[model samples]
Every structure is written in structure tokens, then in C-alpha cells.
Target: MDIESQNSPQFFSWDSLPEQLKSILPLRHSYLIKNFNVLSPFQTTENFEIPQFELDAFVDIDDKEKAREWFLSFESKSKTTMPESRRYEIKGKKVLFREKRHCIHSKLVKEKQGNRELKRPQSSRLRNTNCAATIHLRLELCNIELSHPLEVNLRFTHNHVVNSAESLSFRRVNGEIRGKFLELFKDGHSPASAMYDYEDALYLSATDEQELLVLLADRATDPDYDYIAKLFHKYREMALGDRNGTSMFKRLEEVVNDYNNSGHGKAILQEYDSRTGKAFILCVVTNLMNRVHERVLQSGELCYMDASASFEPLNTSITLLYTSCMVGALPLGLFITSDESEITLEKA
Candidate 1:
């Protein structure tokens, strides 16, 4: 027979197929045949218990995007992916896809003595098996209308025995667990704290640490700090908004320069050295500080000036001029200097 004719479904029976071809059949098919007399014509009349192969019931989603999101969520839990060789097929409004994954086993066996051998063979690694398990997702239109919601069906098929403890799907956070995490996050708990609470609620051993944190961070309203930092470098204009389209430090410099040039009746003082002609002390009273001066004049006679190390860990001091206001003591002006010397303070 020609290659195509030999491979045709009608051309060969299961018993007549070559051992290599039969071995390549899906793992679940073997399990089905072993558990049920599905291939035997006479046993078709007999009633047999069929094993359940569904992990979750069909879910109805609003749109294709929502269906994809649901499938992704399921895939995340299962840690599996659709085979690259097979493309997802769409028929009418229905989409069908399958995910397959491999299984690995490790074991240690005692060494066996061999005849006339100097030493027995030590324990060796065993071959890994591509456990031909599969998860099928079918998304179909719920109604005759094309715009109707999609109904998603999830089915699991496995040929090998499953150890529930080792399964990713079993360890993954379910809807209930995710809902609790969201509630905690909305209540102002940090991702780390929320993950801790989730573990505590489930009495889980603290072995898996990062999964919950990653999931919560992905769903959080605030952009992750690392992502924001990356965006600040890559998309500086968007990250800074309307702040002169400059980086954070450059924007601070621009504010200082603008205040110095505006001339708002408040002093913009700078003292240069007589020898080097280099600026030694520079301080500016901004337009906002000028308004604060007016408020200080109206509020009280007593004013306070204090000098201390700057909040940031630097060799600089911040001098603050405060006045009593109706809302309590408020700073009228701020001066930052390289040193707390009397000469620098006088210039400020």
C-alpha cells in the first residue's frame, strides 16, 4: 500500500497496526482501553463505569478576550502549553485547543554486584517520559447570535497515575483563594502580606513563596516598582507626565533654575569665593515662599529657624524658617547648604 493509504483510518485495524505506530498513540487512549471495553464490539452492550476526566465545569465568558484570559489562567495553574506543531482550530464561533506536558521521575536503587567485576554499578538517572496527558479547552457561542457569550469547556485526560501532591493544578490558587487575596489587597495589605495570609488560611507549608506574590502583583492596580523603574528609563516623558518632559533629577534642576530667574521679590542669594570665583553657597526663596512670607507677617510675631542634617544621607544640612499659622507652625522657607557654617547660613 502507498504511505497515504497505509496511514488512512479505514485501511488498518488497531490489532493490525505496527507495534511502533501503536506505541505512539495518545496515552489516554491506552488508559481508556484498559479501563473500558471500548474497542470490543461484544462488550458494547455491557454497562461499565467510565472514569471522570474533567477538572472544571464549562464557564461562560463575555468575549473572546475573556475566554483567552480564562484559558491562560487555567494554563498557569496546570503549567502546560499547547503543542507547537498543532494550531488551535476554529469552527464557526467555536475555538478548540489542547495542552500537553511531560512528566519526570527520579529514583535511587541499590547497587548490584556483577560476576568478575571490580565494583558494582552505582545508581544512575532514569529516562524521562513524555506523559501524553492533555487538557482540552473548547469555547463555543452560547446562543445562535454571534455576539453571544462564549461557553468554555475544560477537560483533562491523563494516562499515568497522578500524585496529587506533585500536581501544579492542585497547588495553584483556586477562585476562592484568589478572591480572598484580592479582598486583602483591596484592604491595603501588601502582596507579601496577602500571600502570607493565603498560606496561613490554607495551612500550607511555606515551600512555594513566589507564585502568590507574582499572581497578586500581576493583578494589582498599581504598577510594580520594578516595572515603573523600567518605564522611567524607557519612556521618560510618559513616566514624568507634564513635568517639563525631563527625568526626575533634571526636573528638580529646572524648578530651581526657574525660581532663580522669575524674580518674585524674594531673595535668590549665591555667594562665590573671592579666590576661585566658584559658587560656595546658593539658596533661593521661591514664589511659594514669598506667599508664605505674607502669611507669616499676618500670623504671629515669633518666628523659628532650625538647621539640621538633610533627611537624605548626604553631607548637607537643611535650614528651615517656620512661622506660627492658624493651622499650626508652617515652614516659610527652606535652605539647603553644603555646610552648617555661619557664613553659609548668612548667605542663605
Candidate 2:
């Protein structure tokens, strides 16, 4: 682009910008010049005003629901469905909408002369060169009872020129989409899977996945983790029921029994501390591991043993014996113990 063209007050195509610059661009263009320095000598010197679009104007008397519907219609149209729209006073009935990005305020520093004199160092509170575009909505409600009809008013304002294409791309989960997500959840798909499904259905960007999930969770009346856990428990219950309802320990025992029945291993040995009467060590050396044990024995070098406290399920420790061989490091034996004490190590 020529210097004159670069300096012109012309709109730049969103796709033409590099990926690194896309994120810094504001949703609107009014604050663009103030937030960024124009290096071109012929750059536009005139002040540019942000354009405003009046979405709706309505006053519902004794019909709060109708007024809310009208307000939400504008919200849905603009696709400004971020969770940052907050209800300030439930009794007073007011909702405030603002940009989701937080202002990265400059750190307060004490003056060199006086420690008490603290000051901010920058003209802008937000980090980097991006304009913190302030797009907001204020909904006020007057009166509660039917004695006098409730007065409702919504005012939408923005400090930047709205990007039509980008604004339309914002996600707003309507009833149909929300119902689809709930149906997937009811069908036992995980939250992550449900989120992917929603994203796929709408062709949403990966950056909006978390925001979409948050919106879904709000509609579902459950937190994301809780919803995921519920689905997991449901599937786990089904699996357990199909397997004759065996507990985790019982399943482990069944595997050990099968190994013994096949003559591949003997019953696991349990050694208890005589004074405490608690099983301190549980050792197992299966027939499959016999070759490894023999190799370690033939090498005539003491096998290295290490005990890890993190592996066991029931607050126990696991000890493993390994030896270097021609093939590689071979595991000689496995031991599970209640505690990694001298007695337990000696017994293993």
C-alpha cells in the first residue's frame, strides 16, 4: 500500500490483517486512532466519531416479561451473549452489559520523594495498543407491584464502530440450540463432547468454546465440572451393573484369582507386623516374571529396589525391584505395602 493509501481513513478487511493483530483490533473503530499511533505523515487528522445503532425502544407497563423479551431480542440480534451481562440489583431489577475483557490497570508505584504518593504510569489502563472498547447496556426497572405498571428502559451505547461481520459471529444460544445441547447431555455425552457438538453445529471459533460452555452450563443449572461428573457417574453405574456390580477391589481380586487359576502366578503373599497386627507387606512374583528374576540372580549383582508412595490406591506404597540385563532393565518383582518402613522393605 502507498503512504497515502495507508494513511487514508479506510476500512481494512479483517482477513487481510495478520493473526497477531486480529486480537488487538476492537469490535468497533471509534477508539482506534486514540489507542494506536499512526506513523504515516498523511494520516487523517480529523476526529472520527463512533457510529451508534438504536436496536430498540420500549416501555412495558406491568409487563416485565414482555419488556425482557424485547430487550433479549436486541441482545440476540447483536449476538452479545457473553456472561459479562450482569444483574446488578435483583430487587431493583437492573442489568448492566459491558465488554468481557478486563482492564489491565497500570500498577500503582510510590513516588521517589514520598512513599505515600502513589501514581499510575500510563494514559491507558488496558495493556498493549488495543482500545478497550466500551460497549454497554443499561436496563432500569421502576416499580415492582401491579399497583403501578413496572417501567422498563434499555439503553445501548458503544465507544467504537461495530464490525458487522465480527458482531454477527458472536455466539448466542437460542432455545433450540440450548435444547440440543441438553439433549446431548441427557444422552450421556460428556461436557467436552457436548461443547464440541455445539461448536460444530454453529461453526464457532475455538476461542469461543469456553464461553459457549459457560452459557450452556448457565442454562443447564449446573456447573461444568458437576455436569461432567454426573455423566461419568451415570456411565460408570451402567458399566458396573453390566459386570454383576463388582466393586473396584473385588475386580482386582478377580484378576488375581484368574492368574492363579491359570497357574501363571501363585497367591499374593501377605506379611503382617506381629506387634501391630497390620499387614505391612504384600509381595507377588509371577511365573511370567521368573525369567527376569533368574537373570537378576545370575548377574550376581544386587538388584536396585525403589518404593513409590504415589502409585497405590488405598494409602499404600509400591516397591519395585529391577535389574539391568542384556535385553534391558527387567522388572524382577512387585510389592505393595501399607508403609515403606524398614520391616516392610526387609520383608519384600
lDDT against the true structure, each candidate: 0.42, 0.44
Worst 10 residues of 1 by lDDT: 28-37
Candidate 1: C-alpha RMSD after superposition: 16.0
Show the colliding residue pairs in model 2.
Answer: 28-161, 29-161
Model 2 lDDT tens row, 258-320: 767987766564534447555655677777568666645643575778778865235778878
State the lDDT at 121 in candidate 1: 50
lDDT tens digits, residue span 1-348, model 1:
112222211223445543432333222111111111112111112343222232222233445565556555544433433332234555654433332222222111111122434332572422222333444444554442433233322233333223222322222334554455557655545555655565565445334556444444332212333433343334434433443223543545555676567786344434333365433344656676677777567535776888888574335677788787687877677777667777667766
TM-score of each: 0.30, 0.31
Q: Can you give the lDDT of residue 347 in candidate 2?
A: 69
Q: After aligning candidate 2 to the native by TM-score, how far in Å is the CA of 185 from where it should be?
A: 18
**Model 2 misplacement above 4 A:** 1-251, 262-276, 286-288, 295-301
